[model samples]
Target: MSTKINELSVVDADKFTVSRTITIAAPIEKVWAAVTEAQHIARWFPEHATLSPLAVGTTGVFGWSDHGDFPVRIEELDPPHMIAYRWGNSNAAASTLESGETTVFRFTLETVDAGTQLTVVESGFDALRDPAASMDGNRGGWDFELDELVAYLEGSE
Candidate 1:
């Protein structure tokens, strides 16, 4: 399967949400694993990720070498179909999920004729320190990050 990296995420200025929908040339199961599993996420997402066993309340840390750690929690889960994470947006070295303005990013997946169609909706940016800046930063972030996900799943990375 082949994949194209694109800036497909949409920033909603009024709703304080950023949404992106992309079709992956891989099975839902594979894409689900890449998104939900920490090892796979660390490959494409943060430099290091620590998540506990799958559960709605499980908390973890998504860490980056330059950006530090972001505390994350599983806000919702529905097997291979959906999972939502609430994470702090702080750039501090180590912070709790409650230490800063947090956002919920929900990933919803569907089986398509070609493969899987995944949509991520990140909301609650209105509560950030700088709502516009945070929204803009994450808009670009989701574009690059999800593109990596597509490439990783399609074996083009």
Candidate 2:
């Protein structure tokens, strides 16, 4: 794994966003699958996931045993490069695909000499109920989850 792990934080608290860029010591394709494929994502991200035949408008659910299930929809896709999903807030456990205001979290991958550079930008927290609390929850979320991704890929876990 790359010794250089970048720590990212909210770009603008008023705007309600979280952004981070990290380099993983792995091929772009490997990183791509981890972020785009449900099965791979479940290993590092949510405890369980369900999605296949990936594409824009694809619907799926990401669940954490303690956090509850969150329904998500792929809002954008650019194969092996970038993908974005609109998901319900953690504060809204009952929120569904159509029921609540959602945030869009995007993952972008690029190949570098060392490995793959992944950047994540999650926005629209301002739209959710208890936006401050939601933003605060996710501020720590990307840190924990992305570290898991790094550990899973780097075989550190």
Candidate 3:
């Protein structure tokens, strides 16, 4: 649970996407809880998240600022291993259209030598009219978010 951003693994850029993986020094269950639980999510993710853990048709909002919320619809859930969702596209009270499109985000977790390996992938941006903005924005956002997550998991927050 180091705050050293440099230590995280950077997912190589794909055609129209960016991704990253970070190994948290915690067991898979602990890492999973930190990610899937609403209370734990708020500690690291956006300050406000409304989560529903149903196997199908579950949705929630991420982010706590005026920046607008991203609608998260669970597309796949595999216990302590994988959680895939469609992020962006809204039914939330308030939201935005930064190009009037949405992307698929997948969080894959696994147990490693000393902790859990979490990989985050967000794709489907070729449809975004503003390619530069979309890629840059998400990349920067992920970096900051991961930094915060590391701190939160380490109890530094």
Clashing pairs in 3: none
lDDT of 1 by residue, 17-124 (tens): 999998899999999999999999998999899998989999999999988888899999998999999998853223567755788999999998879889999998
Against the hidden true structure, what lDDT does model 2 obtain?
A: 0.86
Which digits, one per residue and each the tens of the lDDT, describe model 3 over residues 1-157?
5533444334334577768888777789888887788788888888898887646568887876767667777878898998877777332223433444777778899998857778898777765666556777778778888777767777776
Tell me the alpha-carbon RMSD of every candidate: 2.0, 1.4, 3.8
For candidate 2, report its TM-score.
0.94
Error of 1 at 32 (Å): 0.7
* lDDT of candidate 2 at residue 121, scale 0 to 100: 91
lDDT of 2 by residue, 1-157 (tens): 5798567656568778888888899999999999989989999999999987798998999999998888889999998999999998766645776655788999999999879999999998777777788887787888889988989988897
Model 1, global lDDT: 0.88
TM-score of 1: 0.93
Worst lDDT 10-window in candidate 3: 89-98
| Predicted structure with the largest lDDT when compared to the true one | 1
lDDT (C-alpha, whole model) for all candidates: 0.88, 0.86, 0.72
Give stretches of model 3 more than 4 Å off.
Answer: 1-14, 89-100
